[model samples]
Target: MSICKWIAAGTLAVVLSSGTALAQGNLDKLSSFQTTGVTEFTYVEQGGAKAEAIRKTLAGINLPDGFSIDLYAIVPDARHMAVGPQGIVTFVGTRKTEVWSVTDRDKDRAADEVKNFAPSLAKAIPNGPCFSKDGFLYIAEQNRVLVFPAAEFFYESPDVAAFNVIPQGELVPPEEESYNHTARVCKLGPDGKLYISLGQPFNVAPAEKLDKYKKWGIGGIIRVNTDGSDREVYTYGVRNSVGHDFDPETGDLWFTDNQVDGMGDDIPPGELNHQTAMGQHFGHPWFGGGDTRTNEYAGEDVPVEVVMPAVATEAHAADLGMHFYTGKMFPAKYKNAIFSAQHGSWNRTDPIGARVMVTFIDAEGNATMEPFADGWIDENGEYLGRPVDVTQLRDGSILVSDDLAGAIYRISYSAQ
Candidate 1:
């Protein structure tokens, strides 16, 4: 990479990740609209054969001492979730075309109502749903972004107020549209900006496509104002980062990236990256995963300084959605730790990573990971449920979404 090309890319990343760059969303632009005369919203039944099957699957899950798991809701293709700040609703996104709103109307710690959120709007791969501390909700789709004001209250109705943050065909170039590696995940940064991760649509991004990918914020994470202004690519050199979160203590961003495939099952490992600065690049085509260099872009003059992962998880683990555990329900040892889901391997001879993982960060910001929950794979080597994402409830207990089982399971702790 030439100095000029690197500088040109880093310039925008620097400007965005810099502390001085702050969000300027037009809050006044958010207005409530009713989808009157439209009432064909499909609702998921809380009790039935499907729910019983999910409950039976949860019975075989393994967790640590003092922890328990229960079937929270029956959701189809549930990917990532955003528990409403008001404690009235939880918005769940899916790999399909629907985002479901789940509500525990009785405060029973289990969802009572599960229905499509914005059934009137056609969503394309709306897989990530996140909320701001002040009640704004953001959903990251494959090729667009949308927001809802007072989503907690409006989610009860089939038609909630919806507005485009990054309109269709604007989040990424329409010509580069793809279905693979396009499930975007999003979160609100401390600076009140919306940070969305764009997965480059390839096993290893091509050399010719890297420049264009960086320009369009593909294969990297980008931040924009709440109203979708002042867009900038914050992190670069990432390959299909499906999950990330900010450290509540230091405000630093951490993410998990799916590594290169077909390099044998155990050579190039999966990554849990820590980004502490602007324009920081996590090795992608250069280093497949960790220090293992890629076979595609071999012998190339590597230019930018690549940020290695804090922890190189097992290869082919397929680590997906993650969140820092900030709840009070668990023991003090778990505070500030990270809870992430490994969706398990797709093509490995022996499957791995179909469970929830907890990583403890030491005082020096170093991280170590271990299996917090597992046993989702059956005795016959079949996946009972593949965990996708983790989020905390108001009660401090955490909820995990499983797309394989099409359900959300709640993990709460109580002294035995």
Candidate 2:
């Protein structure tokens, strides 16, 4: 059968099995040139006993001098966020089935509303949200890609038009799906293509699975047109890169790769990689984390040239979402620097991470990673909040999403 027929049949099977009527015909309305509804805003109350408790916790967060952190909104399982063109609304996604719409409708710089975005749609792990300059909102799901037209305008109601960019089961084979590394992230590259990361489901993929993973682009980043055609692998030899972004200056791709585990805590280091050209392989199973080879691939000959990381972070740091600071709210030294979230370590004897990191890129394309905002891990090794993704709002403040706290925090700089 043709690919089109196969896709159609697979889509039907998925719809029938999932008991969801998200058919192509229904979503196709997203492509139409119609604006059908009046935009409405919902205001969320920010004061309560629970709010006071959260605010008290925020006091423990430490940042640079002249910086303060404030509670932005109470969003459950907030993962990644995409701010709209005019900064009127911020669309957030999660590792679960819901995408949230957050708005500061009164322009108070504090969110006045936070609610599910298009709650009518049956979404699965809609963890990645990217927006085009022209009001097109693309969400990368675990097994699908969806585009919402004029998401900011029609987000208040459930009638917002959404079209599938990559149909279900096309991102990765359904059989290979696993709970590990299934939280996909996406970004609209400067070249106008949508880039999605597909993390291979393994701590260190075995040699037997290397070829299959490469063939499926399972351990790499894939790119395609805005319409979801011409799909191709952009990079490979990565274990599980949950976060990546294009450099604003050179348009090069830089990503954070979670290193391999069970290597005595400190043997293999987490990676911050710079991809200057396409198809460049970063050492993965062969070199396990940074340069330490895994037992599974020991003594095996590496076929391709491995690209060394720009910076090697501590092992098990679990670096996730990242963004380059381009907002004017911060000092000049912070402009164009990278801010990433270290989701904290789980397997290490002494937990390390659960904070935000800053990487300054030099003129020669080198990176130096350092702790930016910490205090998430207390002296007793307890977690206050685990930072997931870092993004900048229109007014130059930085927003950090914490899944553990189920809230988003805004970091603003004010000189004393």
Candidate 3:
């Protein structure tokens, strides 16, 4: 055999056996290439007929008056997004193995390039990406948490510094891991701690599993220091929360909880909850979703006080990623409003969501939600795009990610 063939076989053997550890070793080969400046990189552009088709789809989307939606980039399976400081790059996560880096080098609003961020490390459903103000990028996976120091500067080459914040199987026990509700979303709280959502692995957690679930915070949000210290449950009794954000003004946490299924299609509504303090429980097993009681725990006595949702959305809208609008480009009325994505529903006789919704907060902290952008779901119940997460850009525009269509869209406002 040729020398090159022998080397390739050896490399494959190591990768198949050692996995990520071997992959990390291979990244050393690219260490000599320094990633110093943003201008040095040239990103691949999204154009041609595919871009035109995406544009056509965007034209059908309906936004409020004076607002327009444009194709920001064509990202595959773009589950969640975390824009880097100054919005130099947008890091996107997915339910699959790869995380993407979408860059707009010349500040054109449209992405100049969309490419895999860190191709060296073997990832398991890296669905959540969050960046600190100081330039640290963190990704929350199914059963692990990884931190990439200075990810914005060093993402060009594969030699980016990577460390585990929470090692594999430590986020949740290996025995308790399930295929369901493992799409974890994370964010850096105003308190500077890393908050992660651990969705319980069941529709209605069985009675026997309640104790373990509470202990591990399997159905709740967990917070810890950036270094993974002082881990504790911030809230409990949540069925499955795929999206959450800290209110920029109040520093309070708000999240979207996917309510229990199997209740009649329209009986139990999804929730947008407010957590004022720690240890608060949002009714789950005791009350399946909203005020509807679960069949399993219907007659059981409530163990703790339940905090009702701030806003009760249409049942099975599959509400996900939310953000408080702090951009100046929009009208003053939209300032501090909550913008969220509804990924749409399955198993319902009628389809719902698949668009963006806005929530207005009154002086007394009361929230009222209304549709801000629609038309993703057609009259025949077909989904043109399933919106997953909503994020903001430095240019004061909003970016919405769609996992089904594998695309990210930019929503901007203009008086004209």
Give the whole-model CA lDDT for all candidates, comma-separated.
Answer: 0.86, 0.84, 0.85
Candidate 3 lDDT by residue in tens digits, 1-416: 11111111111111112223424343234333433222221123476655677788788898889999999987778899999985678999999887889988888898877767766566788999999999999999999998888899878764566777898889999998888999999999999999999999889988898898898899999999999999999999999999999888999999999998888889689999999999999998888778888888888889899999999989999999999999999999999999999999997899999989999999999999999998988778898899999999987899999987778999999999
Which residue runs does candidate 1 get wrong by more than 4 Å? 1-36
Candidate 3 or 1, higher lDDT? 1
Query: Root-mean-square deviation of each candidate, in angstroms?
Result: 11.4, 7.6, 5.8
How many residue pairs clash (N, CA or C atoms closer than 3 angstroms) in each of the candidate models, in the order given? 0, 2, 0
Q: What value of lDDT does candidate 3 attain over all alpha carbons?
A: 0.85
Query: How well does candidate 1 score on lDDT at residue 41?
Result: 54
The TM-scores, one per candidate, come to 0.92, 0.90, 0.91
Candidate 1 vs candidate 2, TM-score winner: 1
Query: Which window of 10 residues has the lowest lDDT sum in candidate 3?
Result: 6-15
Query: For residues 1-416, could you state the per-residue lDDT of candidate 2 as single tens digits?
Result: 11211111111111112222434344544446343232232223454554676788899988899999999987768899899997889998999877889989888777787767764466789999989989899999889999998899988775587788999888898988888898889999999999999999998887788788888789999999999999999999999998899899999999999988898878688988999999999988788887788887888898789999999999998899999999998999999999999999988999999999999998987799999998888899988889999999988999999988777999999987
Positional deviation of 162 in candidate 3, in angstroms? 0.6
- Candidate 1 per-residue C-alpha lDDT over 113-175 given as tens digits, one digit per residue, 9 for 90 to 100: 887886556678999899999999999998999999888887766556778899888999999
Question: Sorted by TM-score, highest first, which candidate order results?
Answer: 1, 3, 2
Sequence-dependent TM-score of model 3? 0.91
